[model samples]
Target: MQSFDPKLDRRRFLIAGAAAAVAVPAIAQDGLIDEPAAGTDPDVVHNISSFRARDWRPHFSSLSGGAILVDTGSRALHFWSSDSSTYRLYPTSVPVSEELTRRGRTEVVRKVVGPSWAPTPSMKKRNPEWPDFVPPGPNNPLGTHALYLGWQYYRIHGTHDTRKIGRPSSNGCIGLYNEHIAQLYELVSPGCQVLLI
Candidate 1:
């Protein structure tokens, strides 16, 4: 029998622990641990990878069905179904100002397909290089659709840049990937209740 070496044992233990930590999240991301709902679109399944681990799973919510809930802190959105137990999760971008993400109840005042973008007065002041108007198209910052909020100036819109999801990169609007927004737009309609928290 060989004598025990404390240093070698500690090194092996650390190596094993580090490997386990990395593997757990990887497995979760691959949809192995958190199986998606049956018949979930492949694109939606792919989009879930962008969400943080804590925000990836579905849970019971007290909010009524047919409601949209935005969790700014987690950079995630949940569209609750009529049953309340089911929801579609999507990652979103956060606003630069915390105040812009005020918590309250609101409704979708309007819905537009291929929305035009006109930088607000404050936005123009902050970025002089920004164009006064951007026509609705691939280049438009609003992407494919927009759900205008009753709170004014705020929206849940799509973005041409997919990488912006799950980041703090928007002025005040919640940004979802173009494909994700297209799917969301079909599910939402004018006057739908929206809760920002």
Candidate 2:
């Protein structure tokens, strides 16, 4: 057998390794690699209010009335109530949690009247002053009613602080004014599709 050239062999090996390193991510980006699901971190506080959705009009005609669509960027939640392109637009607020705010398709998992608030572990960790639980009442963070999302720890709920509506101030949950949430609670039911974008 011919003598092996160490330098040439090493160079070839390095080039092949570099090519694979580049190709691996490309394959993964194309959905070749199985990745783990991402987790959400709860926020510490929710006291904020400023912007609001002022105009309400038929913006899109594609979605069917009765679907709930949330625009995170604008902090607006729309409930299509009729087939005639008209929809109820409510100013809403989302949590500072970016991952939880990511675009995804999920349905209303549960509906509750006068729901209580239970601080998530992460939330409590962030805010040591937060109580372990909050009872349902005028001061309840859940407000009058709550529409829980399929994802854990996320919901479209009413807030005692109506000012927070239209502000970015939650731990990943969506907040609507008490009256607005009451109307939404009546209009929606379990299994209603919720699109968060």
List of clashing residue pairs for candidate 1: none
lDDT of 2 by residue, 1-197 (tens): 98899999999999999999989866655653223235522211121232232222333334443568787877888676545354577889887768546567787889999999889887889899988888899978989999999888889999998778777888888999999999999888686767887
Q: Which portions of model 1 miss their true places by more than 4 Å?
A: 1-26, 29-65, 83-86
Number of backbone-clashing residue pairs for each candidate, in the order shown = 0, 1
Candidate 1 per-residue lDDT, tens place, 48-108, comes to 4554333312433444436787878779887865555556878898887785566778888
What RMSD value applies to candidate 1?
Answer: 9.0
RMSD of each: 9.0, 16.8
Q: What lDDT does each candidate get?
A: 0.78, 0.75
Q: What is the lDDT of residue 3 in candidate 2?
A: 85
